[model samples]
Target: MSKFKPEPFISCYGGALGAGVDEVGRGPLAGDVVAAAVILDPAAPIAGLADSKKLTERKRELLFVEIQAKALAFCIARASVAEIDRINILQASLLAMTRAVEGLAIQPEHVWVDGNKIPTWRYPAEAVVKGDSRVAAISAASILAKVTRDRELVLLHQQFPDYGFADHKGYPTAVHLAAIEKHGITPHHRQSFGPVKKRLEQLDLF
Candidate 1:
């Protein structure tokens, strides 16, 4: 992929700030859909802000702290696993993003979401493909979302060590599949997800 080049900040709202939003955990087999909204402080610009996936865990963690401290406004929110199963992951992810922005301490005039689809919201919002990499605020939101979800998974490992949520982060990896097959699904697993659904059917759990 080409290196991200952010376009100039353009907000048509009446002297209001623009919040960048992004979601993580849409692809996970388990866990809530986490999202973040960040209104960056132009004066406190953070270096090394890029797509969260492009950075190492250590780097991402460092930036996560920096963003929390330096951002003009930031909010982290999530759609529950039950909501993900009921509304589906796409809608759940969007809902999470919307919630993140809505929860921000500072109200924003516009919202820039990192994706092709926009959530149902009254705020002036637009979606940009790969905005997480192209937009600094979106990148910061991505880092916050990713780090928050990863930390949740690590904590979940304490309750269910067999799934190795700390390692796979709820993705359908080989180890995760093996564990699911051997131990069955947990309440955390999304029943709507294919792997979890198939396993539930196999075990006649559903």
Candidate 2:
């Protein structure tokens, strides 16, 4: 169990219908940026809520299931590689988070986003420096987004075994960079990213 206890939405925002938003895969070289919005049910308090990065895979998987089952409402959304290339990773991340919050079954009175910036939206929202660790709803949202994106990368690994998506989850690791140098870029790779763009330029030179 984690020693950190996340603050409840009702206590932080003073709202019964508050949603927490978070995004994952922003730094990955491949795959879509995934986001999630979660409205926790105060009646069903989940234990051990913490930042997704702080939790092990097994723990996150367990919490993913629990959050889905217990949350009042939750939505997972994504911004495609094309969208990321068209707009930019940061904008795409915020766009995905916006989609997540908009897709929620129950609209929230206020939204708490996990980062330092909130997307352009109409709902009352505030950005928390480390909401995933400090806010219960944000922790749940982070778990959902992280688990969802990780699972997609695992699936991508099956198709491109040489890239080892399952191992590094598409981040620009040395092995992934080597694979790009050897196998070249895939359709799933974000062409706008620095590493991918440079690799593409190098390939063009050949």
Candidate 3:
């Protein structure tokens, strides 16, 4: 009955603990959509909390550890490139967030989701714009998601040398576009994306 935060998600749900959810890799041309949910301890002090995009990799890695050590519960989940292409990126992102939240050992009373749109889930959810920076729990979740996804993309770089997955993490950078133009798309590349679609058109292939 209490009013939620004016941000994307409502504050806490009734009296249940507040869980924050966030994701990364939506804009990538390759790699999976990774998401994380974190429940921060109300008693804990949240220092140095900020948006994952605002922090350096070292900072995010450090905060990630702190969040893991302090959070009441947390979980990370991913939806692969194939799933993204099949379900569409938006749905895949929501699916990834849902999986992350559901994987929590205990269900949260309310979930504060980052971004303007809320996912279709049975649990109570609050959609917060820029929630990652506004909410400590969401910020922690963002750090976890970004760090985990970035690490995976770094590993993928070894498998696909031409696209420089490690460097750009499948973003449609000039290098990535050039790689698509030269070698065409790999299984990891999202063929549905614009850059990949344009490149395939030039080659007269799908």
Best by TM-score: 2
- Measured with C-alpha atoms, the lDDT of residue 16 in candidate 2 is 78
lDDT of 3 by residue, 53-94 (tens): 989989989988888888889999999888998889999999
Off by over 4 Å in 1: 1-16
Rank candidates, lDDT, best first. Answer: 2, 1, 3
Residue pairs in candidate 2 whose N, alpha carbon or C atoms collide under 3 angstroms: none
Per residue, candidate 2 scores C-alpha lDDT tens digits across 71-108 of 99999999999999999999999999999999999999
lDDT of 1 by residue, 159-194 (tens): 999999999999999999999999999999999999
Error of 2 at 128 (Å): 0.4
Which parts of model 3 have CA positions greater than 4 angstroms off?
Answer: 1-16
For every model shown, what is its TM-score relative to the native structure? 0.93, 0.94, 0.90
Count the clashes in each prediction.
0, 0, 8
Worst 10 residues of 1 by lDDT: 7-16
> What would the C-alpha RMSD of candidate 2 be, to one decimal place?
2.6
